[model samples]
Target: MTPLFSFLVLSLKFLSADCKTEAGFCSCSCQKKELIMKAVSILTVLSAAVFGFFVGISFPVQITPQLQCGILPCSSGDAANYSFSGTSMIGILWSAFRNTNIQSNGTSENHAVTKPKGAEKLPPGLVVTESDLHMRRLWGSPKEDVATGKYLLALAVGYSEKANVNATVHKFSDEFDVVLFHYDGRTTEWDDLEWSKQAVHVSARKQTKWWFAKRFLHPSIVAPYEYIFLWDEDLGVDNFTAEEYVKVAMKHGLEISQPGLDSTRGKKTYEVTVRRNDAGEMHKTNEGGRCPDVHQRPCSGFVEVMAPVFSREAWTCVWHMIQNDLVHGWGLDFNFWRCVDNPEEQIGIVDAQYVSHHGVPTLISQGNGEQEGSSEKVRARQWAEMHTFRERISNAEKERGNSAAALEEYHP
Candidate 1:
């Protein structure tokens, strides 16, 4: 029994003896004193039993060596066999309870209880996965067996451009994750190429690259990649190496960049994209009369949508700017500056690692034959989409300006 309970029991016995010996001197009669003593004796015994039970359990428990080691750090050899004292065990339990209480109250300084400042702006924990090319082992962790690539190379491809696509995939090392958006629904045929087995194939017949990107490449889905290469399959990568291009882009701090187009080859729609033999590794070209100013697009901060590389941060904003209906991405290139700060410096072309844009009318002739005025029809749609995009941006700017004016007026 506990010392406290034993003392209480002894005091009760003494009181009962005193009552019997000085029955006349006592405040109550002997009969009443006997009844009261009987009740007090029963209660005292019951209370003492309960107190003793708690005291017994509170004594130092013989924990196994494994459990003791888990509770406290164990040194090698005999130290691991040592048992915890009652005092030490109690202290450990009290400490654990106190920590749990602090966490439950949400007042703990621990990371689990309180988030760091600016954590709200951080991206969520997300990773992209592709279909396994081979059967997985039953024993090992799935993550251990999977090889995650750092960069992404996404292409909109047709079966006709298989040779060019194969050449393009070869330009990139295994560090890049290849994802082919098949517009012709001929995914099985690509299996002939060795790299095709590892690549992720997303088949959607007669859909534009923009449409595929919008539907599949959500910001969260591709968040793990350092950079995303969204390109058309018609591009020639004879002069380009993905690793070298990344190095040049990183050296120049280009967030939104592209490989420079060969001057003589490909449709030179924009003068800024044309590769300069005299220009060092990369350059921000200036189209004097075409652009309103040297700081603007087509003069600076410009790359065609045919082949563009985006940093993870920049692509998040660009992905949102892509319209659902306007899959052509005609006018989107002009507004690419909105995604980055000081676009004149961050957006440019890598001249050292350039690509030849083959103006193959592969995509234009998908649903319809090239001889049946498909080119004209596509061009007309592009013009209409560009007009709609410009109007939307203009309207958005006007609304924002009006809201700011009203807020200022109200405060003043």
Candidate 2:
């Protein structure tokens, strides 16, 4: 029977028959027909509202032209806390998570996340449509330092060797979106094309290679990747895997997590400082990378200068450090200082897998001498700037959330 009819019949029977819920308190003042109509009215109203809510969002969504970070909120049955699940960040149950940002004060238990920053300022294109309804598929934004979204992996390589689409896109044992920039390849505007590992000819590099970073590598790349591997033409690894590295990174949040870098004839290692309690899983080791020491394998400050992974968050912090401030020569590798020791980003070194720089360094010995010396001067200036950035990061970290024990890791 229809719900209205069923309710009407039951009400009439209760009124006439010996049925009562709580005796005197269960007495119905309203007529049976009146009670039945009210219940039906409420149900109909509720059903319509719910149906409307769904229909409102039925069409494909569009990205709001303006860049907005997405994130998800947590819910019951969720792990109660977010974490990296080796590949995709789980816990994001839907798409609303994309609206979260630092400024948003929302109360939700579970959600996924997009990176921070971006806005649309188009007055003419403000009209809405399906194409731009960009959603990260996660529910909402997460709290700070909480695992909320996927960090894209990116690579910046020289266009010459990579000019003909010759560069190989390394696969993470886990899946991730990898964006490649064949910077300023010939005839391309902005002059470079954003591509993945597709076999196609890239353009030639623009002549204005900054002596320091060499070519035009934007700071924007820092926003997309959780960790970016800045690599040159020759990077090879017999056994190093990206999936293993992510596991290690979660164990130790470092600004620059350079896995035990193994080079041609030697190894150099740097330890990331963290305030781990004695009971924590991170083993304590002495100064050098010796065991019983429990620290890590060998490391050279610049063991290979070939491929180094800089986490997206870490890279963004690093981007502010050197972008536009330093000209050239401090070298992106050497410029990255350990935030592990400072107040800001304490970078750590991990031991998982290693990548080898396959290209051999060859001296051309033909550039103009004055020009070379000028480049050297520029590089030296960069070194000084790098140190300045390091100090600033340390200062910032301390201001945000420095603990009393944080100073224990600071040698200077």
Candidate 3:
């Protein structure tokens, strides 16, 4: 029997006969049939209005743009979290939307999707479409793989005979993103090599590495990477592996660190930076009588400008300090400890993987050859720049009511 008829019959039977509910409430009525009919009519209209209101308030969700996929409205499922690969965002969306057993051309179709549970409802004044989400994924805003390695190697090359850029690229290519900042302006020669083709190249003529770095390797550009190896081309890494160096540095918690320099290659002034393989990954050595605060000493809070490796946090601060006009980076190393916190423990040399300085002195030689750039002239300009940097730092410290540490040393 129809629900309405059965209800009507039951109502009539209850009206005609004496009835008692389980709780002992008694009622008898026959004149209320007209009243009951009016009540049902009111209920029917109210139900329709409520249903229409719900549908009106719902956010319009577009799962599939192309008819190639299924068109069924979404249901609750775990399919939205599934991983899939495709060139187009639509294909990726299709993968997440698809979970139905129904097949189209041997592929299971997900045309019928339900509203995902816990999905955020659209708020007022905000409009997000399928295309917007797709564009975000296509660009840099996609989901990040937290487990993936985050390191990069930035090499500065001038095609100079003594630099050996190609050999360095081959040595650490697998451990990091080997990027070539070509200062020679010739892009054609690197096109022949497979590694060169894979690497990111930034070209400029006769400019130093710091110039390219100031423009391209900004904190924003290298934000995704955890560590950046801002290295010169002349270093010999035959005794080191990039992976081992990083491991040791990480273990020791060094933020601004570098491989210990082999002092035999050149005249070494600071004894702390000299390699010592006899101890742990990092030795507790320092230039005696320096850093009265017991921290910020050489080989602890300081690393040489050449082949310096900076952690992401340290690099962000260092990038802001780099002057656009000062390309040589002559006076920057002395102030590097200011960028990091607890530099004594957070910065140190990794003696486990040391590199030999080829001692080419390419930048000084190149500048000296220029008409306005004799070695004496370059030295004077460098000193002026360093003096300016010191003045700025001093002013900043004075404004903050904090004293900045000055370079100190004592002979044994």
Best by lDDT: 1
Tens digits of per-residue lDDT for model 3, 271-304: 6677876766776457453544445445357787
lDDT of each: 0.76, 0.41, 0.66
Tens-place lDDT per residue, model 1, 1-412, is 4875675666557556544356555644555566567667867888898786556545534342544354585532224225332223443455564453323212221222123335533332322232322324578787887667788999999999999999999999988888999999999999889989888899998889999999888887788788999999998888999999999989999999999988677767777888887789999866454655676566788887999999999999999999999988878888888889988899998999998888998887775664678778877888899888887777776866653321100010
Provide the lDDT at 238 for model 3: 77
Q: lDDT for model 3, on a 0 to 1 scale?
A: 0.66
Please say which candidate is ahead in lDDT: 1 or 2. Answer: 1
Lowest lDDT sum, 10 consecutive residues, model 1, at 403-412
**Candidate 1 — what's its lDDT?**
0.76
Q: Rank the candidates by lDDT, best first.
A: 1, 3, 2
**In angstroms, how far off is 138's CA in candidate 2?**
25
Ranking by TM-score: 1, 3, 2
Point out where model 1 deviates above 4 Å. 1-102, 105-139, 287-292, 368-374, 402-412
Candidate 2 residues 123-188, lDDT tens each?
Answer: 323433211101233455534322322544444445455432233454452245544444344323
**Given candidate 2, what's the lDDT at residue 96?**
55
The total number of steric clashes, by the backbone 3 Å criterion, in model 1 comes to 0
The reply for model 2, stretches above 4 Å from the true place, is: 1-149, 159-168, 183-224, 264-286, 289-306, 329-346, 357-359, 362-412
